[model samples]
Target: MSSIDSQTTYLKYREYSDLLKVILYSSQSVLGAVPLIYHLKHNNQNIIFIQTGTMGGNVIHYLISNGPPSKKFIELKRLTGDYTFVDKIGTDGMSLYIPILELEKSNLDFP
Candidate 1:
């Protein structure tokens, strides 16, 4: 519990992929999806909103699944494995917006 963590609002992601699959990968692998779930589980999040604006499939999978996207979960799974926990990974064609402040906050184990 710290000042910045309290002032935080929503966790926004931009990459485009099956929200469900991405969430899964993010959870087990500590990818983009981990931040939101971590905040929620810790009661540190104010909102869990994707920044990509293109969402539908598994809007809440990050809190459900325990692994990354499966081959069946994606049409081109091979193209996404390398990007397992990255911004452009798994995305068909999307951008990533990682907040510098938020990212810095992730490294700090708040007391």
Candidate 2:
């Protein structure tokens, strides 16, 4: 590929990475692990901590099930699908205060 083509590809990949980061952060916010202020200013969304799902399913399921007060529990289930692998963040006893540089090298990867 030409240099221009490679540069275009790299830029597109970067955009996708950024989009993924937004999605991850937003989901984390829904779990009340982190605030969404970094992503959105003047945000008025009520935050709710996802309770431990000892029953079954993943963390996403837990959040959807126990979403904010305005949205009914049943409504959440109707709006979301099953997330097979995700679970509650920091449930593994990991420290949230780990430095930003260390986060990139975090061994938080799951199967």
Backbone clash numbers for all candidates listed: 3, 0
Candidate 1 regions exceeding 4 Å error are 10-62, 71-105, 108-111
Model 2 lDDT per residue over 1-111, tens place: 543333221111122223233334444565644311111111232222221222332231111112233212211111232122222223332222111110122111111
Candidate 2 lDDT (Cα, whole model)?
0.23
Tell me how far the alpha carbon of residue 6 in candidate 1 is from the true structure, in angstroms, after superposition: 0.9
Least well predicted 10-residue stretch by lDDT in candidate 2: 98-107
lDDT values for all models: 0.32, 0.23
**TM-score of each candidate?**
0.21, 0.17
What's the residue-level lDDT of 80 in candidate 1? 46
Query: CA lDDT of 6 in candidate 1?
Result: 49
- Clashing residue pairs found in predicted model 1: 13-51, 24-67, 25-68
